[model samples]
Target: MTSALILENLCKSFGSGADAVQVLDHVALDLPQGQSLALTGDSGSGKSTLLHICAGLEPFDRGKVVLAGHDITQNDDAAGAALRRDTIGLVFQQFNLIPSLTVAANLAFQARLAGRHDPDFTTELARRLGIAQLMSRYPEQLSGGQQQRVAIGRCLAARPRLVLADEPTGNLDEATGDAVLDLMMELAAQAGTALLLVTHSTRLAQRCDSRVHLRAGKLQVPA
Candidate 1:
């Protein structure tokens, strides 16, 4: 089967020769459709950098990144933005909801941008996330957990081929985090969206289809 996301011999660094710090060295990954892969590492281990590369938000020095059969490494910023707008969903720890837009509007924002807006799907998704009641309220009106639920909803609104979550539950307490994870997994699976999750929580990592640990810019199977 075709992989949902792939990275082969990926390399990345910051700065020029003298001050350059190699962040990723020959990293590789293959995430299949409807599967979740957890990325774990210590601070400054390049997990976020790797996620950004996969998202096509950051360019790498060498190697390949393919998403849903397209070579994201080859895309220019405009193309990358288009790809990200259409094919990928992102969930961040901070729950980057628009304070200005109402919950309903925020949820539909990206879907609209992708030209795939579906009011029916958005309504159903909100209902599924248990945020249907808050549709009229602004993000600031919700709790952190509620904001996160909205963020997750927004990610799924476009029915993206892949979902990249960067410590999605980091801002929540253990119980809330677990709850959010359950909902995220359930919803992503229901939509057949592949998941690439970056997290420091071993429990969260263990919940994915597989776990890969990062250290000093390299990847290893959890021993």
Candidate 2:
């Protein structure tokens, strides 16, 4: 079976000449279906950069990144956006929920955009996230943790081939964070989606199928 995600000699840099700051160097890794991989690194270690590059929101100067079956490193912006819309789910530190839309609408947004909307899946995901009762409610009406659960439901409801989360539980307290992470892991597994999660907490990272560290712009299993 094809890997859900593959990074081969991925390299990225900013600026130019002497001022050029290389953020990613020959980074490589893989994520298979129905499993989670934790990405842990110090700030400025390029964890988010790698995520953005993988998501096709940013371009790399070297190497390749394949998402699902597409080679994202070769795609232009339009193709990248399409891939993101059709195959990828991103959970950010900020909930990023639509303030004007009801929780149900927000949950259905991406799935609809991908032409993969399933009312039953949306309902089930909302229920699993513990936000089914809040479906008709607007984002502002919910607490921080509630909004985050809605955000997670939004991603998983789409049934994306790969789920990329960058500090998804960062804004919540420890207990809430743990609960949110647990829900995300369980939902992703149920959907058979590959997950690449960027986090700082070792306790959280240890729960994943594997853990990788980013340093000097490379990814490696912890020594």
How much is the lDDT of residue 38 in candidate 1?
Answer: 96
TM-score of candidate 1 versus the correct structure, residues matched by position: 0.92
Model 1, residue 124: displacement in angstroms?
A: 3.9
Residue 191 alpha-carbon offset, candidate 2, angstroms = 2.1
Q: What is the lDDT of candidate 1?
A: 0.89
Model 1 C-alpha lDDT per residue in residues 3-119, reported as the tens digit of each score: 899999999999997999998999988899999999999998988888888888777899999999999867778988888999999997768888999999999999999888999
Task: Give me the candidate number with maximum TM-score.
Answer: 2
TM-score of each: 0.92, 0.93
Q: How many backbone clashes does candidate 1 have?
A: 0
Off by over 4 Å in 1: none
Candidate 2 local lDDT, residue 15: 94
Q: What is the C-alpha lDDT of each candidate?
A: 0.89, 0.89
Task: For residues 1-223, write the lDDT of model 2, one tens digit per residue.
Answer: 5699999988899899999988898888878988899999999998998898889887789899989879986787798899999999999777899999999999999999999999998898777667889989999999988888888889988889899999888877988788778888887888788999999999999999999999887777996
RMSD of 1: 1.8
Counting clashing residue pairs in each candidate, in order, gives: 0, 0
